[model samples]
Target: MKLRALLLGILLTSPVATYGAGGNSVVTVNPPIPAPDWTLPAIQNAKGNLSMSDFRGKITYVDFWASWCGPCRLSLPALNALNSQFADDPVQFLAISIDVVEEDAWDFLKRYSVDYPVVIDTEGDIARTFAVDGMPSGYLLDGQGRVREIHIGFKRGDELKLAESIKRLLSDLVTSEVDET
Candidate 1:
């Protein structure tokens, strides 16, 4: 974990505000690419492992966060509420903590409880695969696991914007299903 944390610090040297949406910026991937497959252990090992493929055929919102990241403190709770609003929908939300130390993540979660699945990327493999460049980054993936939108940083009202995007995607899914039938 220590080594992974060191490497991440070196790799994530870019300015946070340059790309993506939220309070900072949100960039739509020009040509959506398939999200890589990954299986990560649940935070504190309290639950079974989770994989990217598990949410297949659903609108997956994967959030990369850490207890130490300031923006993440805000993003998690907001996302939790958004997840509840779409509780009956085909949307699935997953939060992955990139904290080097496992305890830090637990401490943060104690105060800001979330309902969605939470996992810990102890080896940092998941974050590297997603090319996470900033703290509290989010990837909105389509049913087929394509990365449709990227969100970086979090600010007040950002959750509203995210909710709108999710609704648009859900509508798209409904349209496609109707066409198929």
Candidate 2:
């Protein structure tokens, strides 16, 4: 009876052996991708309806902002700089406005003279999807569309760090592809 009880206790407490830790263990999170098959209404500059799926092959930065937000205004130059820096690359910088009206957003964009693609989220649908709780939130998506980084507030040196991270991810992707081939 003692032996049986001891064996039962061990069986109950022991960790089960797992293949790669579990059947559904995450090896890695690629980067933020657009939500799966997410088709949004046509944004201002898009030729057709836009979805996160459209940018599947490139690294993407999605900025959730409102024109009235001071921090959002301040971050424009940095975002523009990033856009300029990666002008020739496959990375895309998208600014999504959470403004209630298109004119308010367009006015701000014109005032800023921002050069990157701007997507209007008039209904705040996209912002809600990303669980955005603050203005001027930035999300960096890897080339594979996984969320690689998320920033809620602006900081002085964030742009530089963001650029470096994207470059590093791009390099890693290239290196890995070469290795795989």
Number of the top TM-score candidate = 1
Q: What is the TM-score of each candidate against the true structure?
A: 0.86, 0.76
Error of 2 at 110 (Å): 1.1
For candidate 1, the TM-score is 0.86
- How well is each residue in 104-124 modelled by candidate 1, as lDDT tens digits? 888999988898889999788
Displacement of the residue 38 alpha carbon in candidate 2, Å: 3.0
| Model 2 pairs in collision | 31-146, 31-147, 32-145, 32-146, 32-147, 33-145
Error of model 1, residue 157, in angstroms? 0.7
Task: After superposing candidate 1 on the true structure, give the runs of residues whose Cα lies further than 4 Å from its correct spot.
Answer: 1-23, 44-46
How well does model 2 score by local distance difference test?
0.67
C-alpha lDDT of residue 25 in model 1: 65
Which candidate has the top score in lDDT?
A: 1
